[model samples]
Target: MNIVAVTSCPTGIAHTYMAAEALEQAARDAGHALSVETQGAAGAEPLDPAVIAAADAVIFAADVEVRDRERFAGKPTVTAPVKRAIQDAAGLVAEAVRAAEERSDTAPAPSGETAPLDTAPAPATKVTEGAGLGARLRQWLMTGVSYMIPFVAAGGILIALAFMLGGAEVAAKVNGGTFQGRTYEEITDLSALVEQAGYAGVLFKIGAIAFSMLVPILSGFIAYAMADRPGIAPGVVGGLLADAIGAGFLGGLVTGLAAGALVMAISRVKVPRALAGIMPVVVIPLVSCLVIGALVIIVIGQPIASAQQAMTDWLDGLKGANALLLGALLGLMMAFDMGGPVNKVAYTFGLAGLAAGNLTVMAAVMAAGMTPPIALALATVLRPKLFTPAERKAGEAAWLLGASFITEGAIPFAAADPLRVIPSLMAGSAVTGALSMQFAATSRAPHGGIWVIGLIGKPGLYVVALLAGIAVSAACVIAAKHVGRAVPAAASGAAAAEAPAPSERAATVA
Candidate 1:
């Protein structure tokens, strides 16, 4: 039977695609013709509308509401949560088809003068809560984070630039101060010193100010994504509450979603007919903000500030050879897990240090972070014989991603052999970290490679630092690969099995 499906989840990241895959596979396994559209962070891209129109039935597996419901109005439509699509997709599809058929049979034939389907209220969508509240909340938070990335990058670089400018003009200010018989004149007159100092101070401050509200904005958007226009007010209010309560970005995200949920839930409680729409949009958001804000400011804010400060202080105090060691360790952590929390923590710490005039630390961190992927990439390119056909191909592709400093470029390799591979990665990153520190390398840009010279300090040393790290990582990876076979798949067998069944067979071939 011809079938169309749409899959979505609150996060619009991993799960959305996962659900679609499960449904598609189920359809194939059951020998039904199928096409699926995914509504995700990138937005909806359903199978061709014509296909959907011609299909015998449509299935919607979503947590967040899917738009364009009018298109499937008269078609037999099966509605389900993303989880059901994943957990028991075949059964769910059958049930959905049955439901659709029943609806189709019961509805009266279209009259000569038909009412437009578009004018009718859409069918109710479904959500799966199987992932637990925390998981769901975290996904909602990511929506905000995804939106906030550009703003942070823009604001951060501009502020960093301001610092560079100030550093160049410090000498003049100091000279003027000295000429006026002020000892501070010298400090102000050294442009390089002033600019550096300013970068560490005023420029950073500006960036911080610009980014301070980032979490709240992110939280608000996540709510918006979920509830559409109705989610806006509660999301904003919840974000503010998170900030007040000592909630960091994560907290803001949670509060924003919580606020949206609260508003939505409150809206469901009976209200005067005229006030129904306004209740959620205005009254609920307002009440949520007041409650959340008061609790956050009074209880949460100080702890969060103290925690952030402590983290900053720890990085600030990192010095000499140890600084390199610390950076190396962090870099290894980043590459080992791709973009997991461990990686994010290391990256966040490195960037935070950029505002403290400790660019060397950051330089080591960045160099080490990208070394594993890049090194492996190079190894694959230079000695194709060293890897399996699949591995070599992957390595070759990883090169471009590595060049752009995507640590996860090596994830496929690591996942295959965590025990052996992770150690190799650490060794390589440590070497890079140590060398960068030894060379006193400094960087201005939080990320970027050779092309970012104008944005970094001690470009020559930075290049050397990176080269050293890459060389070390490459050597380690190559040596390990020659000595070690592809990682034992015992641990990952179940995971690999979960890939499309065809993929499991491919793994066997490899």
Candidate 2:
């Protein structure tokens, strides 16, 4: 089989290349001709048109939207997340091959004026029959998140800068009335300090505007993922209504799904050839927006808003042990699978809360997420004799990885010694989470690990919480290693040859 594939992730870092490498190796082993394009932070290498034309099928293993997707418009395509390709490259390739065969079987018969086999490609139709409901839903959610992340990152970083440069009162200055009814422009002329504060106020206002659009963008893209272009308008409109009604992120999710489902249903309706061209441009967006807008505004809006408010009040009211318990649970989930679905779920929960201006949960999550790699790195240093040479090298890399908030850096250690390492990691992460919550730390940014510490509400306590977790987990790992049989350096090196590289198995978080 001839196959062409593209792999991308939101961060366009490790997972993109990992998936590409995995697919290439799998294709070679399976005796298939393959070309893969990796879309990474650095950019992409365009696939040769000849190769794409010759390919029997296309695979998209991406967590973000594929660039120039129309290039594959007439091909049978299989889509999955980049992690899926890394974990099951061979399986995915095999599925793509099967999809190609199905596309061939379903192709329209050749007309009287026949063309050569190579010249006549099958009509473009995505092959999603193999994707289960859960997979599809996950893909939709991830698509939304991938699109929404930039807004959050930009808004958060800018807000953090405002707090740092303009002091905490910058928001008040931007609002005008709180600064003795003086406009920001007038305040800037008052004094040097006031001028600096005015600049900060500008940053705050811009960031707040971006932050305000986060939910609506998330909703729009999620609908686009499910029903393509036609779903976007309705989804955005519905999301705006969700916000107006105080439904929050929860409301955005509801509207996104509802809009996507409505668009899909509408797309299935038969239309005359003359009207078909205008359907997507006019009928679908108009009818779907009206239906979704009305449903969210009149029927479900108040109930969802009330529920959201109740949840917000509960989170805000959590104190002492109750907050600590919730934090610990979040930490455990984040550490349980490194960058897997469990970790994503925990992270997503934090993001949702952050969108609602509940920063404590995000702070706890980030703290917990940073613990595993750092703790393992500390353990490797504390007891070098217990670790193999390869483990020690990986540990060295983990220092930077952990500090950068890439939890997958600890994955190699955990994969090698799951029984002992996992429990230690969970223990450390939970401790960090609890401490962060107890300290009432808050974070505006969704990512950037230790690099964003300056943005933390209480940087001092956050550091203490992080260090405490690292120390506890490091101690626990050291003790566990003392009880277990340690592999000698030479034997461990020989064993490493038989297994996949640790980097290959490590998942990426964005």
Candidate 3:
């Protein structure tokens, strides 16, 4: 069999490439030829047309909409979430083969028109709605986080740069008297702040504008993920209202989900042929926005705002051991499964706190998250013989990935030896989180590892906490390896030997 597949996820980081590698290996193991296209945030590497034409079946393992899906029109198709491909690639391929055989024998539709891109076998709606309630909620939240991250990175880094270039008061200086009491748009005299703060003033303004869009973008894209194009406008509007009403990130999440579900329900309404044309463009947006906007403003706004304020106050009130304990808990969660659902839950919690103006939680979470990869990298450097040559090389790459705060860098190591690796990672992560909290460290940006150190409230302490975790984790892994070699070498060596080489593991998981 010849197979063509496309893999994607909302974040376009881990799952996309993991699924591709899994499919390729599974195909090879099954004595079939497979070509995979990865559509990710880094961009798409599309499959050749010749490969597509020769393919017996197509598989779409995605969490986001596939681009240029028309290319697969009329192909026997199997669609599943990207995680399924990673976990059971062989099964998916087998299913696709059967689907292809059935397709080959079946008669075509009488009209002879190819099914619409979205109407392919296993439509996205079925894929999402078929999942258990918990899975569906996680998927929705992750969709929002994935879309919100780019804005956070850009805005956070820019703001950090502004502070680095100027003094700590750069924002105040830029906004205080620069425009002579005029608004940013209405300010005609750019010369005033330019003369006072130089380029820093300009950078601050730009970053502030970007920061302002964070909530709206999160809400809009969440809706887009849920209801496709029709959900965008209302979602954004709802987010804006959330912000205006001081409902914070939690409220933005609610608005995004509510707007998406409302629009999806509205889209299913029966309508005349004349009205159908305008439903998405006109009726959907108009009705969804009005309904969502009214509900948010009249019923939801004040209560959510009060809750946000109370949460912020509680976070602010945290001191000493209370903060450290919270940080430790968050850290354990982060390293428990690397980029899995447990890790995402911790990250989402941090993001929620950040939206409420509590940067300490984000600081602790990121520090903990970065520790596993860095620690593993350090371990390989300290004790190379314990790891395969391929793993040693992956460790070198892990340094960069860890420095960038891409926690998925550690996934390969964890997958190879979950029992030893995961526990060691969690220990180090907990230490890092506790120390960071103890020091009262804070970070303005949600992403970016060491590169955004300037944005951290206590840069020196943050680095110290990170280093402490790395050392602890590295030591733990080394000790685990040594102990395993002594106690379970005979029993575990065969399974370890059967595990794929480090390069293969990296390709599949990284």
Model 1 gets an lDDT of 0.56
lDDT of 3 by residue, 338-419 (tens): 6444576677678766666788998999999999888999998888767644356557767766776767567546644557
How do the residues 1-510 of candidate 2 rate in per-residue lDDT, one tens digit apiece?
A: 999999999678899999999999999999999899999997899999889989888888876557776566556566666888999999989878876775576443222111111111110111121233433454455445445545655665566567566654576565443222333432433345435556877777777677677668767866866776677899899988876775545467678889988998998788998998898789999999999999988898666556545544454454334888989977887787675445766777787767667899999999998898889888888777676555676677677667756676665566445567878888989999999989989987666577667778999999999999998889988888765343322222222212222233233211
Give the worst 10-residue stretch by lDDT in candidate 2.
115-124
Clashing pairs in model 2, backbone N/Cα/C closer than 3 A: none
| lDDT ranking, best first | 3, 2, 1
Poorest 10 consecutive residues of model 1 by lDDT? 112-121
Per-model TM-score versus the true fold: 0.42, 0.45, 0.46
Off by over 4 Å in 1: 2-146, 149-214, 237-252, 270-278, 312-324, 329-435, 442-461, 464-510
Candidate 1 C-alpha lDDT tens digits along 133-180: 332333344345444544445444444354345442222242332211
Tell how far residue 218 is off in model 3, in angstroms. 2.4
Give the top-scoring candidate (TM-score): 3
